[model samples]
Target: MIVRIMGEGQVRLDDVHLAELDELDDELLAETRSGDEEGFRRTLGALLDAVRRLGAPLPDDALEPSELILPSPDATLPEVREMLKDTDGLIPG
Candidate 1:
């Protein structure tokens, strides 16, 4: 699946990593819901790092639609909360 990290472009992640990503996504959701800013940041950073480490970076010119969209690394908690309200975490299960 193609995952987009806002403000950082896109990466193509394999389906094999979906389960692990989902677990991190769940942690992110819980952190956000409980207003745990530190935990949220840590989890978000881990999630993004996992994507960067495990996925292949797409060429800058690539225009494929992303299957998942994640917040920017510096995104505020409130921004993430608003984003989560519109979807089921960062990945569409």
Candidate 2:
């Protein structure tokens, strides 16, 4: 799958990493549900780091669509809430 880190380029991830990503997604949901800003930041940082570490970065010129679009580290709670609402579901799949 191709995942996009907003403001950054895209990264290609394989099924092998989906399980870990799912766990991170679960953590993100929990943080959002409870409105824990600190945990949310930590979890989001971990998730982003995981994606960067495991996925191969695509060139900025690449025009392919991103299967998953992730928020930037500076994203606010409200922004993420809205993004989640717009997405059909969690991004692990």
Candidate 3:
């Protein structure tokens, strides 16, 4: 009930606060307070896996791991140059 209510945004939360809330899992917030280590570890592992999955590349035979596939249909020269600035020579454009 609390999770559903929180999810529905009855209360405001920051990213770090939400992350801590996820870690607590209804346990006390004090650092000295003992927590369910096994449960926390499992939850953390699952979260990490989910983040990795989210960052995974799309299904493409020619796509390499370092490739930065843009979502734009038609990118302007300035846009392409901006993206390439940080990438150095990773992209040939």
Scored by TM-score, the top model is 1
Evaluate model 2: give its TM-score: 0.91
Give lDDT tens digits, candidate 3, residues 1-93.
Answer: 011121111222233334443443222112112344444345434433333333433343322333222313233334434543544221122
Better structure of 2 and 3 per lDDT: 2
lDDT of 2: 0.84
lDDT of 2 by residue, 6-80 (tens): 888899998799889889888887787778998989988898999999999988899788888899988877777
Per-structure clash totals for the candidates: 0, 0, 0
Model 1 scores a C-alpha lDDT of 0.93
lDDT of 3: 0.31
Q: Between candidates 1 and 2, name the one with more favorable lDDT.
A: 1
Worst 10 residues of 1 by lDDT: 84-93
Q: Per-residue CA lDDT of candidate 1, range 17-82, in tens?
A: 998888999999999989999999999999999999999999999989998889999999999999
- Among all windows of ten consecutive residues in candidate 3, which has the lowest summed lDDT? 1-10
Error of 2 at 50 (Å): 0.2
| lDDT, residue 3, candidate 2 | 92
Error of 3 at 17 (Å): 16
* TM-scores of the candidates in the order shown: 0.95, 0.91, 0.26
